[model samples]
Target: MELVTHSPGDGVYPPTGDYAHAIEVRGAERLVFLAGTMGLDPSGVPGATLDDQLVLIWSNIRVILASAGMTVDNIVRLTSYLRDASYAGANAKARVEALGGRVVPTTAIVAQTLDSEWLIEIEVTAAS
Candidate 1:
């Protein structure tokens, strides 16, 4: 599939951080929509810190992608649910690292999670 990122260089304000204003996916034969995944380890334990949770969440996402013969490059969109807005920077940094700087449409929201221990939950849409 061909991924086209639309970022207006003039007139409109540019997107902040590592994300495109919009993404156009072309010739995609498959679309994978993952449910909201928490930062749980193999034993289903939540991480104590934001960084730790971010690491675990990305690791889980990678495993899920691999199961479908896809990689982080196939990620077209992502939504992050954070316990607090302060975690935004760390979250963005993790996303950049996980996708190797491949920008996609992303949104972050601060919300209360089902489990208080869960500092973050992420859901993604991938196409290939």
Candidate 2:
């Protein structure tokens, strides 16, 4: 796989050391776009807190990535929907850490989620 990184001269640098300006992958044989995943456990129980939900969501994403014979590095984009926008930063930080510093995927965090009981939902797009 070929990856591209862009650093615009006029654009401001990223505050966090984790991500690049952008990532591009070309000549992909297959692409996967996963549905929004909630924080439900194996038995369909929701996590008690936002931190717990974040952890579970990350784990689920990891599992899905592995199923496709890919890793977090293969992800190109992510969309996260949160029950509360105020908690987005903290949740994103937890997700990045869970991925072990690989944060190339572009992310969007929305305040309004589909379910009231859910704290967060994450969708991903990957190629390999």
Candidate 3:
């Protein structure tokens, strides 16, 4: 699949982040909308800490994407919700690792609370 990424063309400096302002896919043959995924182990146990869960969540998303014959490079959009605002750094680090430097359109929100067990949840939209 061919994808086009856009940022401001206004000659201004862009923000420091791993995301593109927007992503465009032309005639994408397939699209997948994944539901919000949270971190959990193979035994279906939620991670004890935010950092651990971040890795697990991304891992699960990768598996799901692979199952659909897609990869993180095919992701056009990513939305992440965090239970605590301070986890932003960890979140960004994990996301960068997960995307492997691919720039995708992304939004991240911090909620006052999620379920007691989940530190983060992520939703994805991919095309290939």
> For model 2, how does the per-residue alpha-carbon lDDT over 1-43 read when each residue is reduced to its tens digit?
7878665557586545655677778888988888998887888
Model 1 clashes, total count: 0
Alpha-carbon deviation at 97 in model 3, angstroms: 1.2
The lDDT values for all models are 0.94, 0.78, 0.86
lDDT of 1 by residue, 5-28 (tens): 999999999998699989999999
Q: Any runs in candidate 2 off by more than 4 Å, and if so which?
A: 11-18
> How would you order the candidates by lDDT, starting with the best?
1, 3, 2
For candidate 3, which ten residues in a row score worst on lDDT?
Answer: 110-119
Scored by lDDT, model 3 comes in at 0.86
Highest TM-score, which number?
1
Candidate 3 clashing pairs, residues 3+ apart or interchain: none
Superposed Cα RMSD, model 1: 0.9
| Greater-TM-score candidate between 1 and 2 | 1
Deviating ranges (above 4 Å) for candidate 3: 11-13, 112-114
**Stretches of candidate 1 above 4 Å error?**
none
The positional error of residue 91 in candidate 2, measured at the CA in angstroms, is 1.8
